[model samples]
Target: MATHRLTELPADALKMIATIAGPVHDVEMVSAGYNSEIAARLHLDNGTVFVKGLRQDHPRVWTQQREADINAFTQGLAPALRWEIRKGGWDLLGFEDLGGRHADYSPGSPDLELVLQAMRYLTSATPPSGVELKTMPQRMIAHVTDPADVRFFEGSTLLHTDWKPDNVLIVDGQARLVDWAWASSGAAWIDPALWVIWLIASGHSAADAESLAALHPAWDITPVRHIDAFACAQQRLWESIARADRPDEWTHKLHAATQAWVEHRG
Candidate 1:
C-alpha cells in the first residue's frame, strides 16, 4: 500500500535538489512507492534522477539514510546512487533513472530466471564496513515460536528481505533490486525464503514457489527444520501486518500466502 503524494515538494527542498543535480527542468511525482513522503522523477537539465525522501521528523526517516548507506555495496544489483541531500528538514536521495518495468513473478514467466540471477549476485555481498545492519535473528526475534529457532537464521550474507515485484525491476534483460531500506545481514538461504512468499502471492502454489526458490544454491544446504522455523516466523509476521488498522488487500493476500507456506512446510 503506497502513500500518495498529497502536496508539491517544498520550495527549499526543490532548491537543494537543484544545487546538487543541476536545474530541475520538470518534476514528475512517482506514486508507486510505499515508503517515503516524497517520491518523484526529477527531469534535470543534465539528466533524469529518481528521488525519494522523507521529512526529517518522520518516524521512518532513518530508512532514507539506510538506503543511502547501502547503495554502494549493492553494485550491479541495484540502481546507482546519484546524489543525496539533507536540507530544509528533509532527507532526500537521487538515484539513476533505471527505465524498467516491475518484474513478473507469475507461473512460467521468463522474468523468474532473471530474478534468480540477481539473487545469485546478491548472495556474495557482505555488508559494507562501518554500516550497522540488522541480522535475520534480530529482525525475527519477536515472531519465532522458540527463541532457539533464531539460531537457524544467523549468517554473514547481506540479504534483501523484501522481494515484492515492484522492488525488482526488469531492465535490459536483467533483474535489478530496489528499496534497500529493509536490507539485512543474514543467512544466504533467507533471501530465497523471503522470495517464495511473493512467488506464491503471484499465483504459484507453495510447492511450485519453493521449487523455483530451490534454484538458488543456498537452498540445497539449508536444513528443512530451519526453513520450517522461518516459515512459521513469516506466518506470524504477516498475521500481525494483516491485523493492523485498515490493512490493505495486498497485506491480506500475503498473509494467506504465508499460511499456505506454513501448512506446506508442515
Candidate 2:
C-alpha cells in the first residue's frame, strides 16, 4: 500500500471501506506503532471497525497477521477481527470497534485493573512448545531479560508484551486490549512485569505501578528478581528505540529497581 500522511491517504481507502462496510460515517486515525503507517478506527452507518493499513514497510504484514491470530481466541477481550485484505502494495485489516473509553494512565485502580487483566490473558494464552522465553533470557538480559533470570520452559504461552492502557478499550465496564506488534510467547511472568514497567515509564509512579504489579499473581518473590531484570532490560530497549530528543524515563526507574534487586542478592 502507498504510504500517505494521516490526512492525505487516497480517498480510495475510505471508498473501499464504505463500499464493503457500508457508508463510513467517520474515520478517526488512531495509532501507528513501530513500523505501522496506519492504524485507525472507522465509524460506519452499520457499525464501527478498527482498520490498519501497511505499505512496503514489511513489518506491518508480520504484525497484522500476529494480532489477528491472537485475537481469534480473545473474544470480547479483544476487538473482533473481521477481515484481512492484501492488495498490490497494501495489507489492510478490519476489526470490530470497541467503544466506551480509551485507556487513561492517571493513578487509579479502575484503569490499572483494566490493563492488568489484559496482561494476565496474554501471559496465560496457550502457545507453542520450547517457548520458555521469547529469546534466550541471557541475550535479552541486558536489553530485555530481568535479573537472576533463567529461561527455562515450564509452559508455552503467547504473550502480548505490549499490553498498555493506550492499547486497551474499556467499553461499558468491559475491557479490550489491542496492539500485538511485540507479541511473543515466553515465561509466565515477563509480560506482566514488562507492561507495568511501560506504564511507569509513561508517567505512572513506581509506587503506583508496583502497587499494580502487586495485584498480579505473577509478582511473587520467586519471580520479582528476574522480573525486575526483565523490567531493566525493557527500559534499555525503550531507550535504544526512543528518539534522540525524547527524554528517557524508564532508564531511571529501571536503575533504581536494579540497584535494589542487586542489593537483595548480596
Give each model a TM-score: 0.97, 0.76
lDDT of each: 0.90, 0.61
Look at candidate 2 and tell me the lDDT of residue 46.
Answer: 72
Give RMSD to native, each candidate.
Answer: 1.3, 4.7
lDDT string, candidate 2, 1-266, tens digits:
22333644447666666666788777787643433566777877777888877763564467666666666656657778888766656667898877667777666547767777766665556664432234435446566443445453223556666654566677876567676655665567666666566556556666666667777776674355565555556556555545344434544554454444334333
lDDT of 1 by residue, 111-147 (tens): 9999999999999898788887899999999999999
Query: Once model 2 is optimally superposed onto the true structure by TM-score, how far is the C-alpha of residue 203 displaced, in angstroms?
Result: 4.3
Q: By TM-score, how accurate is candidate 1?
A: 0.97
